[model samples]
Target: MRDIYSNVLVKQSLTPAVRTATATGTAVDRNAGGGAMFQNALVVVTTGVITDATHTITVEDSADGTSYATVAAEYLQGTAPAIVAADDSKTYELGYLGRKRYLRVVSTVAGATTGGAVAALVVLSDPRVTPVVRA
Candidate 1:
């Protein structure tokens, strides 16, 4: 049995050059799967000018990146106040159940309108162990 250390496998910022209503969030390829490297994989997201309240965010996965599936979903709503601007960022954590190389985030609500603009931030990380066994 192979043992791997728990560390940040990948990290990236979700910044788009052209600000659009429909924009692809951050994504990362694990490239570590087969036996158990992906068994305890964890995904963490950090938002800026975005809050868990008033918006529904999710972490999606896909083998081909083009087609994706919702690995985990979270809806930020409750007693917390609505997130009006992109100044206060929130942190979200999620764990991967199955094997997936590609992962990304999708925002249902783009927050409130500010000067006719909407924005959101997403950070994705995949932490896993080592030594994946093949069938």
Candidate 2:
């Protein structure tokens, strides 16, 4: 049988929290396991209990880990999501195919009075090392 869990590592880019304003996710080091170790990445976003707000999700990349820029459309496998109250209890995934070593997810919240619960996870795969360590 094929084992998917053993070859990949997952990290939280955005901690689960109710947000009322714009939030920039934590930088996920693509080389955390090892230098240039991972060849693929996917950002997964989950939402819960959305209120009177609109949330827009965008993915960004950085080579130096400090300076980041929005990822171009050509390097992304799927479109970033613009979430609304109707999108509550939903999930979205975007694949990153750029060469940057760091990645993050950003959320732009608007017209929010009660805010929304949102979170993001970065899945790193195609590793040069086996059996990724869980932290």
Candidate 3:
């Protein structure tokens, strides 16, 4: 098996919590570890106890951390999901093929009094440097 723990750097884009409103995740720098460049990225979203709400997950990228925009369709490997109650206790993964230096995940929730427990992780892979250091 491949050594995933050593080759990949994982960043918490969204904090795990019950979100009643929109959640804007933190940007993760692809070159954070010793200026090592990465060629691939994956966004993983995990949910629990979804109520009467529709959560639309958007994947964004930034050339600079201050400015962000939605990732283009050509740069995305899979579509961002409009997560519903039926998707409770499930995980979703989206691959990124863009060459942006920073990335994040945002969840937009609507039509809900009680929201859901949602969180996202940005997984940076194919690092130029081996054994990704802890950040």
Q: lDDT per model, in order?
A: 0.44, 0.89, 0.89
Better of 1 and 2 by TM-score: 2
Model 2 lDDT at residue 72: 98
Per-residue accuracy of model 2 over 1-135 as CA lDDT, tens digit each: 137877788889889999999999999988866453788999999999998798899999999999999999999988899888888899998999899999999999999999999999999998777666666
What would the C-alpha RMSD of candidate 2 be, to one decimal place?
A: 1.7
What's the TM-score of each model vs. the native?
A: 0.52, 0.93, 0.94
TM-score leader:
3
Between 1 and 3, whose lDDT is larger?
A: 3
Question: Model 1: per-residue lDDT, tens digit, 27-130?
Answer: 65555333223434454444454322244445677888678876633322222222334425555555555566666655555533321122323222233444
Question: Cα miss at 58, model 1 (Å)?
Answer: 0.9
What does candidate 3's lDDT look like per residue over 59-126, in tens digits?
Answer: 99999899999998899887888888898999998999999999999999998789888999998988
Worst 10 residues of 2 by lDDT: 30-39
RMSD of each: 7.0, 1.7, 1.6
